[model samples]
Target: MTTLGHKSSMDHHLTGMSDNTVERPGERAPLVLNMDKFSQVTATVCRVSEAERAPIAWYICFTLSLGLLSVLGVCIGYLFLTGVGVWGLNNPVMWAYDITNFVFWVGIGHAGTLISAILFLFRQKWRTGINRFAEAMTIFAVICAGTFPGIHVGRVWFAYWLFPIPNQMEMWPQFRSPLLWDVFAVSTYFTVSLLFWYTGMVPDLATLRDRAKGKLQQLGYGLFALGWRGSNRHWHRYERAYLILAALSTPLVLSVHSVVSFDFATSQLPGWHTTIFPPYFVAGAIFSGFAMVVTLAVPARELFGLKDLITLRHLDNMNKVILATGCMVGYAYSMEFFIAWYSGAMYEKFAFMNRAFGQYWWAYLIMVSCNVITPQLFWFKKLRTSIPIMFVLSIIVNVGMWFERFVIIVSSLANDFLPTSWDSFTPTWVDIGTMVGAFGLFFTLFLLFCRYLPMIAMAEVKAVMPQADPHGAGAGKHGHAHH
Candidate 1:
């Protein structure tokens, strides 16, 4: 037993006991918590040895991802040389591959914000394990998504022309245009996401820096961490900043997609002009984004031996979210059909029909099965806990989400009010290559993150540890995953 007097150490307290206790003269009392391994960071901390991974697997991941990035480059170069003709967009379908890709990536980005910000605000202690990587994924996925619209414009050199800087050219990008709103929405989302991801990284970076040995390592971590120290005072302020930033990011999460919806909603196209676009788009975003996260996380968890940290419980939690959002999107589909018929608008009715049974009928069916029926497997706990099932479901969700975009873009334009101009849609190699490249781009960044960064938030995990708790609960401040 330790002394409980001034200038002496105190014994650990019982978990269920009241944190506060008043002692009469000379009475022995314990400090609030029993500091132990279980109490630390909820198993989120990477033991320094665990940080090392098989370098060859990492190399292969990087090489493939880089090759894809190069392919994306070649495709973009070809697009610049050959013009928009390469994408199979002609006649009434002025926007096809670019818009489809834009929506797809935006949807892929939603889960990161939900995992990092929304879950944090809810004080879901379970998020401590994978939130760091999820936030990182958010930043890179947005980068890939933001690039599509940027390069989709033919003149990649003057892509900045989307910016509304006052110039001698006497041309200001029209704020009234939905395209300009995309310019605003995407850029603002990217900027804010970058900031949010970086702020979350500061503490994690400091952990890495403390563990670093060399001079260059010291400087690298020092600069990136912005001179972070594990002072309680610093953490107190840093946490408040993080919470405020999360609050800001949550709204942008909604507004960015809503603005993207506005690009279609405000349009006059039969399929595009609908009030359901905003909420429908948001639900689809979360569904697709969460699926992508599982796709990426499955590999990382196994390859990195993070199964304990990224437990099956976490996957199950995310799967439930995916299932819920999938249903929401499916309901939106029914709502669209109902509204189309109820409104008695022939054009809208025809657009929904053409989506289901028109030239793109296969695309619509694929979307329906993947988004609506596929996630139903998640109702069984076994499917979610099974890695292979999770993997296949992830790919299915991504395919469906892509089809959702294709359906949105292709069906709307291919069979608009003018029957004379109606044309079917097909994606060219350039479209397919760029899509492949975006995956490459996402993985390349993620691989680098796994290599250098802690891949998990070490400090945040520590904060949830029983020792980190100012008030004790049980033997530790935090409970065990198994418990």
Candidate 2:
């Protein structure tokens, strides 16, 4: 039957009215391709990771990322030998690039859980194609996020003091401090996200294990597969556990960024002390996270030659999400200014003004243009559908998000109430190197993931294809096996 006929039949079935049209069994709209057989879907996605040799581009990118990792090491070594004085941080602007990069990376981690958990609960089957990689990105981004705070404590050896573990000093973390709350919140977020990512990959690993060509491949994939046999009983328990994890992660997506905001909201700094920080930071987190996903996925689909699995429809959907969250972030930006002016608090008003017209107006412009204006183009269907445009905009969004943190951190601190203590901040080479190194760390892990693990979840993608629906009209009627 034609696609239109199937739609009409579906409408008729829902309305329970006889339309005099022939309703055929196994008829449904194709989500990705016209002939999406299970075998083909599995072959296409799994082929990338299981190939005898990875693409040359993978080696090139991995090499570059490794160099960045090395740069991060050198900068960190310098930091240990010298001190925080190597950076431009001083006086009122003590919290500068380090905290900004920390928050930026944490925000980048938010989209993975949002896509994996919230969308799964809503039964958005489209998420099945991208959630695996996005979850991987989340884990990597969180790792990058955690690095800054650990190093920022100034004494790496004493970092264990942040935890509640018993130490030779017999000192416990200050439970009342929000900073300590951050330690707990971030660690919990990391732990749960890791579990969620690993659980979802097991079935896919089993698929890889079955397809392995070499004994070593079989052994490695088999080790991670945990003897998954794809039995009905295994699937039943897996589904239940997956549902429970999704439910748990939904709130963590919201709470993690909110708690990160609390690190500032609980403070008395002029720009930081605001009730709107929680929701504002959450929206911004999702906004930046989706942008990063697009940035990674656009190039990824092309490089891996998995365009069919990660189709233009998927890209368009992600762009629409970026647009929505971008608007939310823009609304928050305006609201901050409005509330600042309306409250008649001179300090709040001054803080906002300094952010716009003060010494760091250039950073403010980049933040506004990238975060607010750039995403506006996605409102046009043509633009969002265009891969080149989406890729460029995605990068722009990431850069804008980093500057947003910079503006918030540096601008607020540089112009505090006591002008005598206030001083403008400038980042030293160590600051720039550390931030670049964080990117290295993130991409290095991501590259390793792409090479070793399934970059796309084959089984989940198969589960979402047209043939997966046992009751759909096209299921058994087509030359495809019913699940």
Q: Which candidate leads in lDDT?
A: 2
lDDT of 2 by residue, 1-483 (tens): 222224453453245332211225765323445333578777777878878888999899999999999999999999988888998999889899999999999999999999999999999877877899999999999999999999988888888888889767787778888898899989999999999999999988998999998899899999999999999998999999999999999998899999999999999999999999999999999999999999999888888877777777677888989999999999999999999999999999999999999999999999999999999999898898898999999999999999999999899999999989988998899999999998999999999998788888787877776445555534454533446
Candidate 1 lDDT, tens digit per residue, 219-320? 888799988887879888988998998898888888888899999999998888999998899889989988988998899878766665566667778898
After superposing candidate 2, which stretches have Cα over 4 Å from the reference? 1-29, 473-483
Record all residue pairs in model 2 with backbone atoms less than 3 Å apart, i.e. clashing: 25-473, 26-472, 26-473, 26-474, 27-473, 27-474
RMSD to the native, candidate 2? 5.2
The local distance difference test score of model 1 is 0.79
Which whole-number lDDT from 0 to 100 does residue 1 have in model 1? 17
Q: How high a TM-score does candidate 2 get?
A: 0.93
Model 1 residue 149 lDDT? 86
